[model samples]
Target chain A: MIETTVFAMQVLLLVMGCLFFAVGTLGLFRFSDTLSRIHALTKVDNLGLGFIVLALLPLAPSLAGGLKTVLIWAAALAASATSAHLIARAVHVRPEPPEAKESADD
Target chain B: MTLILNAVAAFLLLTLLIALIRIWRGPAPADRMLASQLFGTTGVALLLLLAHAQAMPALMDVALTLAVLSVLAIVAFVTRVVRIDRPSSGRKAGDQPETHHD
Candidate 1:
């Protein structure tokens, strides 16, 4: 009974994670602006990944496998944050329009 | 148990697809960067799921490396922006008129 219950929980978590991921993707496609897309992608992606990882923990075959799973989760979180920051910075430094340049000179 | 993992993996794959769209159609460099970040996150998640399914411990190293590299890339990009925005030495090449010693 306990094993069955655990399996059910894992399945539930996985389904929820997938649902979140799907919604996040939809948000990306629906949003008009980059910032809005980022907002959707970051929040949903992070939570979705976290839940998926959590679901996998119980199924890990060995102690080492479990440890590794946790480590990957940690890494994902760090990488996601940094990558978002870089992308945002790149957008901010783009060249200004010709009209804006002319106005500045005037 | 395996069913759950499979479902989650499938979802992660979908997320990756969305991120790819963002990377390709993003309006600005920052947007692309954000997409890439999403890719990194999804990649790590996928790796974790795979490791669990396959019972492999070595794959975690790949995720760690990816995480570190992503951060390094962000730092480099930020520094580049700062350098570009800094004042350009505050002196012009053709400023002889302003240097009169009389």
Candidate 2:
């Protein structure tokens, strides 16, 4: 019974994680500007990856493996947040030439 | 359970392909960069799922490496591609005008 329950939970998590990732990418297509796209990618993908990590934790072969798995999530989160900020800062410091009719809102 | 995991992985890959469309068509460099970051996250998730599905522990290490490498790539972009100019002719601007190798 316990094993069956765990399996069900894992399936649920995996499905949810994939959907969240899809939505994050959807944001990229919907949003018009660079900063908005970053906003979507960072926030939504964080949840998506977090769900996948949670699903994998129970199946980890050892305590160390589980920790390593969690560590990957942490490292990715740090990288995403830091890189998003840096990219935004870069865009702010040196504004790019606005392409013609590129942005939806003037 | 394995079937579900595979289905989920397939969906994630589908989303990745959708993201690539934006990467190709994005107006600004930052937009492309953000899409690539999405790729990194999706790739990591896919790696973890693959590790679990295939019973391969070593692949998790590969995920960790990819996570670390993605950050390094962003750092390189910010430092090299994004030009940083010291505020010209203000406080400390006179100290040493910023210079770019290229």
Candidate 3:
């Protein structure tokens, strides 16, 4: 019974993770500008990956395996945050060409 | 459970393909890079799921490596912009000096 319950929970988490990831992609499509899209992608990377990690923990073969998986999540979050900052800074430092229509968002 | 894992992994891949459309339609360079970041994050998740589905724990390491590498893509994109824009930025400083304000 306990194993079955865990499986159920895992399934739920996996679905949630995938859903948030889809939403982030939707933001990429619907948001008018690059900055807003960046905001949306970071959230999905953080939250969606977190949920997926949580769901996968139960499948780990050992404690070390679980720790390694969690570490991946931490590393991913760190990388995502750092990259988003760099990209946003780049966008700010060098606004798109003046003639470009999308740069008008600036 | 393996079936469900495979299904979810497929769903993630589908979303990834959808994101590719954004990459294609990018009106700004940053938008293209942002979609690239999306690919990195989603790829990590996909690898993790596949690791379990295939019962190959080593894929976990691949996922970790991907997680680390994804950041590099954005870093390169930013530095690439900054390197090319530095001289002009110095000139534009006078017209709109917003750098120090932040």
Candidate 4:
């Protein structure tokens, strides 16, 4: 039935989303530079989240629930985009960041 | 479907473990902050997966809040840690001519 097919697609999307998330995390280990790591984390992870959200849409409890699900995706995307730019800008402003002077890192 | 969602959520946690390694090995402030960003985002996805798998609607609000807080964390790092305002004032005139503007 069509419902079965949709279910299968959802499962596939969910698995693929997890794979993308893993790949994004992999960038942190593989890339030595901070900006390069950010490049991988921000862009790929958003794609991963998008896939996961798509998979979950069919399971939403109601129309309101579904819209809220989509809204989460939108908010995450905006956050990632803005933070990526901000982090990149921060890096640009200071090629060398002082990690030792701050307590936040500890 | 619920089983698969739970499995996917578990997989995301593994990714978070990898990001933790990045944090442990960071040589720059941005690198560490980036690891935390990964944490925030991965946490969001994990919450969503659980919300569906466990049939809990309130977790969605939690995810939204997490997203907002994560971005705010980045902003804090920029303003307080990296101190974004310093570049314009700290440098001498005609030093690194390309950098001093805005």
Q: Go through the candidates in order and give the C-alpha RMSD of each one to the true structure.
A: 9.9, 5.9, 5.4, 4.4
Task: Using TM-score, give the best candidate's number.
Answer: 4
lDDT of 4 by residue, A46-76 (tens): 8899999999999998899999999888988
Displacement of the residue A22 alpha carbon in candidate 3, Å? 1.0
True contacts kept of each: 0.67, 0.74, 0.70, 0.71
Per-residue accuracy of model 2 over B6-102 as CA lDDT, tens digit each:
7777888888888888787766766666755875698889888888888787888888888888777776766655544434224463465333376
CA-lDDT, candidates in order:
0.66, 0.79, 0.81, 0.84
lDDT of 3 by residue, A6-64 (tens): 98899999989999999988888888987888898898757998999899999999999
Tens digits of per-residue lDDT for model 1 on A2-98?
A: 9989888888887777777778778777887776776777788789888887888887777887787777777777677655655554444443223
User: Scoring each candidate complex against the real one, what DockQ results?
Assistant: 0.35, 0.50, 0.50, 0.63
- Residues A7-99 of candidate 2 have per-residue lDDT tens digits of 888878877898889889889878888888889888999899999999988888889988999999998898788778777876877668345
DockQ of 4: 0.63
List pairs with backbone clashes in candidate 4.
none
TM-score of chain B of each: 0.68, 0.77, 0.77, 0.79
| TM-score of every model versus the real structure | 0.73, 0.85, 0.86, 0.89
**How does model 4 do on interface RMSD, in angstroms?**
1.3
DockQ of 2: 0.50
User: Model 4, B51: alpha-carbon shift in Å?
Assistant: 0.4
Supply the global lDDT for candidate 4: 0.84
The model with the greater DockQ, 3 or 4, is: 4
